[model samples]
Target: MSNSLRLVIGEGLEHLEAHRAGAFAGDPEAIHQARVALRRLRSALKLFRRHLNPSARDGFNDALRALGRTLGAARDWDVFVLETVPAVMAVIPDQAEALGALVAPAQHERELGHVAVRALLEAPQTDAMLQDLGSWSGDRVAFSPRKAARQLIADEAGPLLDRLAKSVSKRATGLEEQDDEERHGLRKALKSLRYGIEMLESLHGRGNTKPYRQALSVLQEDLGRLNDAIAAVELVHRLPDQPGRLVIEAWANERRQEALIELPAAWHQFKAIPAFW
Candidate 1:
């Protein structure tokens, strides 16, 4: 079990490093993938927390979270400029010129965000942190050598996945009435559940996991549309006051209403899917 934990953590590190160059170059997909790697690593640690040394685990979690924040800042602007703005532009063709002008400020902010990403990548602490984590994953001190550490991952994955699934359902109980913060909480829970399923997919086999994964994907997409609206308002407000900003706020409100109307059906569909694990 200890060896299994090391393998999983090592694979996460490898994934994180693989996208380093692309993320450094400010590629949107790479930045997203890099952020995902950080998330998977953090999820893996929490999934197998009982088997790890608390002090070392806390240190690694803190470092990974800091890196995640840096990547996330850049990713938010990427989604704004690349996805949200273009989406609005498509619907309001008459405002294309106004929307196009808005892109410059968002892009500038994005570039500044990427500058922070680059700085973090170049910082000595980043390398040291990764190296330390990589080493710790294999170190005897990192593993508690408890009974749980000796159990097979397959035996444990099902319960771990169940907990994550329940977390999403619990947060989603009053979905329609949830405030932005609560809805945001549900989104986070959904992501964790999805990641948990992905991490354990090999254990369950693709045939068994496919239906649940698909349902999860659809539910996530619905919630994401709603989230994009909420996020769009924040991004637009950060820009100077202008007509384009007003246009975006109105567009965002429309998107939010549409998403809210569609959310219940999507949630119900997701709820009906049987647990694959």
Candidate 2:
């Protein structure tokens, strides 16, 4: 367990360094990979929290959360401009100018967001906090690593899996009437549950966690598509009144309705997966 934590933190740190260097270049993959590394490290901290000193664990978690926010904001714009705009454009070929109008300001937003994230990464405490986390990767006095490897799957992982499963099952009802806030809430909840499952990946060699993860991925994709559509609608709502705005609204709504059609079955498949912990 200690070795695995060390490796995971090391991998995340390497990616963080890469992202920090390339942030101003506005590379989408750098933004995406860095956020992913932060998530993986956060997931690790959550899993092995019982093995960390309270101050040590809390400090790292809080710092990572703050860093993730700026990076997340930047990535959202990147997705909207680079990825989502093209799809909307394809849908309304005649309104290509309309889609570009939306994409332009978002691209500018991405540039501004990238600056904010770059400044955050260069903050004074940022380096010290990352150093502390790396040291934590090596610190194992709270629990014996070998003993944790033997018992953690049942004692720690199983209960979280059970709780998240119930939460998803409960929140997933009445999706058809759900507002934007409610749908976004579901997307975040499902992502948390999926990340929690991923934290226990090392323990799954003797079990069937892969299929369980696969089911969650499908559900996540469905929720994500819905979110992109909603974001499109919101962007169109923000644009200056023009004839093209109506066409863009119609295009986004079509995509959203299709996702609403697909969500229930995906949610059901996720709930039916046998718990793997």
Candidate 3:
């Protein structure tokens, strides 16, 4: 196996171990880090599929995706309750009455999220999935030719780009509906796209994919800010009435609106860029 593949597999297993040990300790940052490792492993496999069995890689990818989604929900809820709510309160001090209305519902949502995360962790499939990954890592794999690698990358890049386009479209739809959860899902999609782009850059030079990279970066930043704002709003809604809540809420609202306006333009720029694939 190539050094990149070996590194990714090792890193993935390490994180999986931590996850299995409940290292997150119900902490959002820990959960996010574990999810990120899973993502990196998935992206690595996608980028280097030419060096492995397609069927085996696909199965591993599917498992990682499932785990990532579960962890993502838990992390999002954690951020909303612990980080975002307070920030929102700071921005909208005058809206204390409205913010108070959100506390019970946010707490209820967080409880549900906690249950889901625990269930996912305890699922039997998780063990089997990790074993499969272990098996793959232990096996010695041969590398494909450069030509084959290029072709595989090109093939995968098309589908990846399509996935990103669909995600952006979904986010647009969610924004129109004012569905916070759906918008957060879109942020997750943007993250996947950004990570994919980073992996691709490892194969293709930065110069070759500069426009795509730049556009993707802009989208990632915009979506990241929006996610933070959304989390802030949820957080402030959960906090007891406080003097600083109004200021935070106002700031979050302003940031959210700015991010919303910038997202489409960044997305359009991303769409216009020629795919290196």
- Find the candidate with the highest lDDT and give its number: 1
Q: What is the C-alpha RMSD of each candidate to the true structure, in Å?
A: 1.5, 3.4, 6.2
Tens digit of per-residue lDDT, candidate 2, span 88-187? 6776688888667676666778788888877887787888888878877866653444555445444656766667667676677687788878878788
> Each candidate's TM vs. the true structure?
0.95, 0.82, 0.63
Give residue 33's error in model 1 in angstroms.
1.1
lDDT of 3 by residue, 1-277 (tens): 3444555577667866776546235656667777787887886675566567777788888989988888877777777667665555565556656655665666777677767767877788887787778667556543444554434454555665566657666665635455667767777676666666665555554546677778878877887898788667666655676644565577778988998888778767776887665
Q: What is the lDDT of residue 106 in candidate 2?
A: 66
- Pull out the clashing pairs in model 2: none
lDDT of every model, 2 decimals: 0.87, 0.74, 0.68
Using alpha carbons, what is the TM-score of model 3? Answer: 0.63
How many residue-pair clashes does candidate 3 contain?
21
Answer with 1 or 3, whichever has the higher lDDT: 1
lDDT of 1: 0.87
